[model samples]
Target: MPRFGEDYHHFHSQPEPSAAYSTSLSSWAPSEQQRSLPPPRWSSSASWFVPPTRLLALLLLLTVALQPALARALDEEGEGSGDGGKGGDFSVDMYHIPKPFQFVETPRDMQVIEERAASFFCHTSDAAEVSVQWRKNGQAILPSSTTASAEDVPGGSVLTILPKMKDNNATFECVAENALGDTISAQASLTVYEDNANAIPEGFPQFRLAEMEEEEPDKFPVFWPLAIEVEPDVLEVNCEATGDPEPKIKWFKSMRPLELKNPRYSVLAPGRLQIKISREEDDGTLYSCMAVNEKGVVFSGVFGLYHLE
Candidate 1:
């Protein structure tokens, strides 16, 4: 045998391969093989091969194309539904009938000295729209009268009288009227007394101090000048006084006048003061009582309160 190198060279130097063999070899190459293979078989329709971006674009176009048709259909349906339809032309009327004339405030019974002028007020709920009139003893009171006169007020009318002994035991009423209806208030009476010197002497009022009892053992008296520690308890202070003329008693806290009408405080008589202790704020509160008359005035010593811990 010849040498191996000499034999390989002699075999490669043979004639070119056949056309069919060359074609098969070319198909075996990576690029050519991929191109020659058959396409893959899908389980479903060709739509599965569509890209997600293209599918999203197609959906958006469909929605935009259908919007105007959907709107037109809704409008036609609304028109057929009559007044109850959405976006349909309609109106609603709301009204309230006028309320009948009613009294808001009425005059109270009054007592006055002889030859003194007194005024009675009559108020109504709708005074600006309603007409107000005053009547005395079932007879209409004239606006131009020497002894009595009726005058228009902001919310009602006023009946003023220059009282005499003959005007005693008289009845007065307020009448309110409007287009809707009319109403009359309860009758108010006037009492007149003769002015006598012996009944009340002309002099200044006098005041006297008194102690109040404690409700609890730890509680302090209301009239103590020094601060006293006390538990939560109701407290009371009373000032007794006598004068030539009767005096009115008023209570004060920290120099401010106390409202006697408050439910927390009570003025049993002119001089007595009662307080209910409900909170810690009542501690260290300065309290004073005063008596007033036509002639003069008197005040009690200031007292302080504190809460007991």
Candidate 2:
């Protein structure tokens, strides 16, 4: 009911709010019980909202939990691929291993004419990686005389020699070697004969001896004992003799004179005979040599030639 002027003056005269009163009215002034209570929960619609850091932490936990399962799945897929996932173009053959050298064909004993070329042949398996060496009389021969053919597969090696009489009975062997081991071939021998001993005599003509002043006792030709069993690729026999005059010799097979014109048969001076290639027909055949001169005639012991098993 006061006048307007008086009411305005009274409102201006009222005191301003003090710091203590403001503190008492502030919403931050909470009691002990309210402080002990949990914070207020958000509304249901807003409950799904989460801080970025919390979301990231949950994702990391999920990843760690699934790691073992992912690894197992990858391992299973690799096994199903059939190569165990070794990958990157690497390969291995577990079943096969390198092998040692082995002989296929061994050299054979041979007889060659004097001053002629002699050849020997030998073969081995796994030739590509093998190295061949020729040995004679237990000494290594030079490689210049050796020739190898068919390098990529099992093949043969040839040894050629221009032989002399000194080479008679020379033993030769072939050695093939690889990373694994060496293979030694059986021994082979060379028998060399003089060309003059292989030459054929001309015609055998009858001759008369001139009378001498002093009469001498006639010395007939004689032969030593011959081998009972002879087996060789080439048949060779010598009919040695002792006589007053040099004796002329003739060879016979099975009681018949050998075909002198046949290329396989060779007759040399005094009495060496050779059959180039002995055949099955030559088996069990008897061979003999006859010697005749002005004084007398003689027959050598019979010999039977056979083939080796």
Candidate 3:
């Protein structure tokens, strides 16, 4: 029924035979023990086969003419079928699908899944509306063959490929969304070959933007363009740095770590291992940042305190 649909519900439109049709015929069919006997008139014993053969043909003809009655009897017995078969509407589906509806920790960012092992699937129940977002770690992927249809309503959005190579462990994710709230998906990972491979590998897990952090309103650092803009009785300046996985900022003054101190200034963000300095004589000095991560430390743009000019 490929021309129609592969579903079990799709029975041909013609009427189906009754269940009782097979069973009831057994009762009406001829019995072998009572089969008609051979004629006594000088006949070979082999001729005993002729009468039973003729009786069989007669019974078959009778059953053919009476098929309608047999079918009707089945209907009375609740075993008859209708066009497309009434039983086809059982409407019970028990397809086995993965459940528990949770995900493992997302793979590390910037990692690629190896070829062959690099395979993934995307899913969405709202194909007519919002779609499944493919995130490596937490980034979206665009495909040239992206497709959807209500006819295939809630269609499965899948991506499967045997990557030719791999370099790092990779995590793949598919997120399904609709007018309802979005559902973040569980993560799947892949293993890849060493970096020496000619190809970087396929099916890299998606990259993720650093998680955004919250800041305390009063403690948030502010940059002033003018010294007079702040209190004339300024005793010290405190800075607070906030970032994901923490950002370490080294305060610099005059292109170097400020060398003077009055013990009045203090760093608000302890994670930066911040140091502060203050001096009445150096009130107008310039200060900036030397921030660092796994890569290395770097300075921020210079900011001036009290302007001399």
What TM-score fits each model? 0.36, 0.32, 0.22
- In candidate 3, what are the lDDT values of residues 102-216, reduced to their tens digit? 3332222222222221224344433445455665546665554232111111323434333334323545666755555556565666554432323333222111211222353
Candidate 1: tens digits of C-alpha lDDT, residues 290-309: 55565434456678777667
Question: For residues 16-95, could you state the per-residue lDDT of candidate 2 as single tens digits?
Answer: 54442335445445445434544443442454567889999999999999978877776777777787654323345698
Clash count list over all predictions? 1, 0, 10
The lDDT of each candidate is 0.62, 0.58, 0.41
**What TM-score quantifies how close candidate 2 is to the native fold?**
0.32
TM-score of 3: 0.22
Q: How far is candidate 1 from the true structure (C-alpha RMSD, Å)?
A: 26.4
What is the full ranking by TM-score, best candidate first?
1, 2, 3
The better-scoring model by lDDT among 1 and 2 is 1
